[model samples]
Target: MSDQTLPKTPRDDDSVLAAEYVLGVLGAEERIALQARIDRDPDFARHVEAWENHLAGLNTAFDEVEPPAHLKDALERRLFTNIDSAPQAGLARIWNSVRFWRAGAFAATAALALLAIVTLREPPSPPATGETLLASLVTEQGNTRFVVLYDSSAQTLRASLVEGDTPAASDYELWFVPAASGGAPISLGLIGGEGEKAPHVPANLQGDFTDGATIAISLEPAGGSATGSPTGPVVAAAPVKKI
Candidate 1:
């Protein structure tokens, strides 16, 4: 039997394009191309259907509002009154045009999609009661390495490695710097290699874990920083914010 390979499925980029099409945000040429694909390609048609279904729920949140009393009159004047010379043919032609309905649907769908995106992007509400502080530590290259959370009640600092490449033969030392400009960086402790760690926050330093404080991780020798102060290069740092 002759060896043959099936076509690869469309990537995430295609899904995004399909979503844009269903949202009516694609430009004229792009929309035309996608519409052609939807008509001929079953996979592309499914992608469009999926996006439509996913976004359909958002429509329920929008309550219908009645248009202004003069709006209908204005539309009639603008579209029909201008065709006084050939009133019958012109009015019928404009009324039968698919472009008019398509434009209205496009505008409505685009507005709904925009609202949904803005709503989704909003940050979640903070907890009701907590002396919790959180920070997202990232390297100089802007790559997130860890998510750090400090709980004042428990006097504990939790560090979760999200994404990063650890240096071989070196350890990561945690440090806390107070918000004050003259305050020095105090070493918290050496972070473990495991993906999750909850190190006890020193009682004396617990008071310093306030908002605007800075938490950092420095790459040090296996034994950790030699001089109490950070002697090695700082790998990631983030400012603590109260929740």
Candidate 2:
């Protein structure tokens, strides 16, 4: 807290601070303070924008992941080894170098989420007779007029929309979210908001149709998301449960 103005010194730490912010490695207090600085300082704001642009391409590229067991310790050793509890002047040094404790912040932010991850057990397979699975897709307002039934043997869901409005030039896309943590959602093509339309599950996703997996309805363009992930608002969703 020695110098809030240190980041405004020059583009050296300023640009690195921008990268740290975009990477989301700052603490809650630091983030709020830095964001305020960006709002008032146009030059610093440009640095944030530049870093955002540099990291934008990574959004659709990197998949969700769990860090390795040694990741936390390794990052701590590399980044926090030189940090000290020196006088207030030393606090300025630590504050000025934003990247120094970035790994710590990143680790702190993710540890709770990582600890909350439930171990994914291999879900029981559906019987060959095809267990009937039902999911009532509802909007945020708790509208449940959209229902989908899954046929385990067929690897398809019969979607029947009793009520829902579809925007012109938009299609309702079905996605399969696996039970395992960090798994990406897999698109199961499109479904119509009308009587009994069977949406085919891709061969890869078909195996993951066990209970605990979830099915969601997202509104997309006429064709679908250009990116492999959901790019639009999720209108309704429900967990696939065997009846």
Top lDDT hit: 1
Best by TM-score: 1
Cα error, candidate 2, residue 30 (Å): 63
Model 1 lDDT, full chain set = 0.63
TM-score of candidate 1 to 2 decimals:
0.49
Cα lDDT of model 2 by residue, 1-243, tens digit: 675555455677889988999899889999999989998999999999999999899899878799898999886444322222222221111121233223323332343234334312436545468766666554544332455667887665666554444455666677887777888778776665223323666676767787646777777786777797888776665566655
Q: What's the residue-level lDDT of 109 in candidate 1? A: 43
lDDT for model 2 comes to 0.62
Cα error, residue 18 of model 2, in Å, equals 66
**Candidate 2 segments exceeding 4 Å error:** 1-128, 193-198
